[model samples]
Target: MITAPLPLDEDLRLRSLKRLEILDSEPEEAFDRIARLAAWAFKVPIVLVSLVDEDRQWFKARHGLATCETPRSVSFCAHAVFSKRMLVVEDALDDERFLDNPLVLGAPHIRFYAGAPLLLADGQVAGTLCLIDTVPRSFDPHDAEVLAGYAQLVERELEVRSQLIRLQTAHERDRRSLAISEARFTTVFKETPVGNALVDLDGRFLDVNQAFCAIVGYSEDTLRTLTFAKVTHPDDLAEDLALVAELLAGKHTAYAMEKRYMRPDGTAIWVSLAVTLVRDAAGVPLHLIAAVQDIDSRKKSEKALRNYHVELEERVRERTAELRRSRDALQTITDNLPALIAVVDRDLRYRFNNEAFRRVFGTPSVALRGASIQDTLSPEVFESLQPLFARALAGERVTCNEVRYRADEERVWCTTYIPAEREGKVTGFYVMSHDVTEQRRTEQRLREKALIDPLTGLANRRALQEELGAILTHVGAVALFFIDLDGFKGINDRFGHDTGDALLREVARRLAATVRAGDMVSRLGGDEFVVVSRGVADAPGAERIAQALCHALARPFVAGGTIVEASASVGVVLRGTGDAARSVRMHDTLALADAAMYEAKRAGRNTWRLARHTAADKVKLNETRYPAEKAKSNAKKHSEF
Candidate 1:
């Protein structure tokens, strides 16, 4: 077999493929859906989104194929990538390049192959979105265009994944930087010479540095129990209280003054104090951050020290405002996205949510924040999602399809959970969900169209094959009835095509009504119909069903104001015993039934014949004829069987 040579830009192409970070990753539904759709559209046995690596061609998404990868040397997709275009092989046996290929000679037996090369954003070929068939078939230009369109979809999904990875990398880098910044701030707070404390609006200390505890001459726990008012000198209390009130009232953001603190020994020490009020996003006061420096040694330098403290407080306020603006901007971007996005902490409480999430769940921002997941979602939904949440919290990235019924309408969602990890532990998880209701409905409709006969609304030929295959797996006796209407062509020739169609519909209805509830009825195109009945006890039981069906269609059908008389010529096959039954495949049974049908037609029509398998695995026919007297009496009214 001829192997494909590597492209001149092989190194660059490999680099681009690696940059996607998609090789050997778990299959994603988005990619799997594209592969399934391509297979369905092409009616091929296999479809794959193959990414060509240096040593192997890996399947990112595969349908109807069991293996995950194949060697790159004999890979058809590698050639497609190297050529940077679609490759089509109508018949591998006829093509010299693939005639000796292992895939063509062995399992899966590739005969017809078509691949559309997947191109990355950088113009490097990754691989192909390919279709494979065991039989040789011709592909027209339109088919190529369709394949190319599917390839484009794969490229787009790859691009989206690449962008998401890049974004996550940037986010992780930013988080590490923030952690470093916090670490530095913590070191400064604990080890700095100047005293620093975080105080609530009521003047109680929420937290204090070691320097603050030393300056106050009290332990950290002791300072937490005492309010600033209780520790301030009696002479300085009124002025300090006045300045705090003005800060709360927004008269000024920061205030600096000389204050005296009465220590445990009742000795007062003068200090320069700078206090700044910190507000939330809505400009509500949250806390007061204070910095104290000893001014007892040089009381004359109080003004200079106060000015320095005031400037420092102003810088702190500006930094706080800048961080808030950045946070608001990020929130805005997330809020406008179509996907419902949320972050849930380890406790299963919502730590963050986007506007889309709030709207979808019908919860307000204030109510949703810090709300338990169980409380935010309905009981049923919460229960259904609990396992997924647990898996994500256990550090598994999960993707699943969820269906919900709301107000009598079915809504489908595709959801993904990505764990947030810090220091080798899962701290939280991110939720992203997209509404896929329309897409799922469309797929359902397509499936229905494929299986149901549009004209008669009965199971079609394809459906019959699938059902028969399943029925043959069991050991029970099965009877297959192949019915052909006697003189359907004459009726069609005389009454016109429209009346013929109406008559066929009437026949289909009668056949369906004649069969048992467990039986299956199908129309196999062009005036032929089939019925499959399972659990039959013997050949007589099978004959009885065929007779009933023949009798049902023997009745006259009135269509388009024209009365048309038609009778059925049915060929029935009863599944045989022992080794013979095992050897009788679905098609073999169908052929036997079809041959018996012709026997009934030759036996004069309006009759049924049964075919059974012999020990030699050959079909033997048994004819069951109608009574001569009954045939004579109904000869003019109905055709003889």
Candidate 2:
């Protein structure tokens, strides 16, 4: 027997596969369900989602197989990966390459085989979605097409899982970065040379750093209980209070002045005081950041040289230099932050903005200041955000998500509006926006993948449950048809699973086509299907639907170039006359319909049974048959088969 040859890019391909970090991972339901559906579709006893490693082909998801992996030398999937396409072996025993392969000769005893290579986004073949059987069978082009479709589903699942892993990794990295940033801020605040303190709106000190405690000649604990007003000299108190009132009134964000502080000994020392109001995202004042620098020596020197113009000029230069240094430090911090932040006054003009705000809007800081919001933003974007801005101006905190285009690429931004209040009146608002495009896309992918049946492109059982619950809660009357395919097992046994899967897909299509536009049709796994019909007024209307479904299934289907016949055994349950439907549980209705389906099978195949709810809330079954002419036509078609 010949072993599969390695591709020219074997090392690169293996590296790409290992990068997914899925080689030896635990089984995921997302993958396992795909395997199960492929098994049911192909009517194969063994199906696997195989990932080819350096020395082995490992099964990430396996159905009808116990072993987790096999040596690459004996793996059929390895050959499929090497070929980078669908590989079909009608009879492994007759094929010279696999005739002596251990998997072909021993346990599992593979004869017929089909493998579809799984390709990643970068065009690297990781492994294969393979079907194995113990007996020889032919695989047609249609069979190959079905296998390819299932393979694509496996690829999508891999992409989604990989994307989730990457996203999680990014989240962890961001968390670490955030923790580091907070630590740096704490260090900077505590170790700065200037005296810094956090004061509340009521003039009470919330926190004071070491420099502040030294300047005030008070312990940090002793200062916490005292208000800034208590430490200020009485002569300077009125002016300081007026400046604070103006700060809170949103007339300015910050103010600076030479002020005198009274120490415990009643001695007054001059200080250069800078106060900035800190507001939350909602534009409400949270606290005040005060930086005080002891300037007693400078004040004394200024008094001694009051008549000297040169001395006065020198002092002015020194003070200006210190203020520039403080402004530069604050600017450095704001520019490093990733989020876009800006302050807008009540007239919708920009008052202040961070570096990120300028970068995102492509405007310089000088251009952005005092610019109207409407002029700074595109007409479309301004129109969309006008109401949110108005809401903030009206003292309402608002948050919304928006889709915007920049550099011809679409992005999602989460923006929050915080109203700044001055004496109970709104004076301005703060805007903070973050990009969330990737996050939104990931959530959307997860949602879509969860609700759809990858094999048939129909809604799965979960979607059916949700739809059923919604219908029962709102609709007056509804009918549920539980359909089980008749004589399906015989077709699978005769024509192989490939043919059986094709037939199942055809059945799903026919079932969908037989229902009304608003009717819901879903596959409940294997050969079972369900159709939900809303606004069915009576049993006759429900019966007509069931009959139509049975007749649709009764028609002969050509799968894998062979004529095959199958019929439907439908069990129907009709619920509600009006609001009474809300009282019926989804599970109870489904259970009754399932039981009635069994009764239809027991009565005879190719017919339907109606399950009616009695006054006692128990179910009573009534058998129904097709019209005589339709029954005769079905019989004649079966006879031809």
Q: Where is model 1 poorest over a 10-residue stretch in terms of lDDT? A: 632-641
Pull out the clashing pairs in model 2. Answer: 42-497, 282-418, 282-419
Residue 117, candidate 2: C-alpha displacement in angstroms: 1.3
Off by over 4 Å in 2: 173-180, 249-251, 263-270, 279-286, 296-641
Tens-digit lDDT string for candidate 1 (323-412): 345444335545655577788999999887888866677776557879998887778888888999999999999988774624355677
The clash count of every prediction, one per candidate, is 4, 3
Superposition error at 578 for model 2 (Å)? 87
lDDT of 1: 0.82
lDDT per residue for candidate 2 within 1-641, as digits (tens), equals: 89999999999999889879998898899899999999999999999999999999999999999999999989888899998988999999899999999998898999999999999988999999999999999999999999999999999998997798889999999997767455434533554445778899999999887878888898899899999999999999999999999988878767889888999998988898878776554457777878787885445334222222222222222333443244443454345555677789989998877788666777876678899988887788888889999999998999887747264667788889999898989999988787779757864774676966766766789989998888777746678999988877778889999999888888888887777645778888877898987656567668878888988999899877888988989999998665555667888788778767766777787899888776555545653333236456545534433
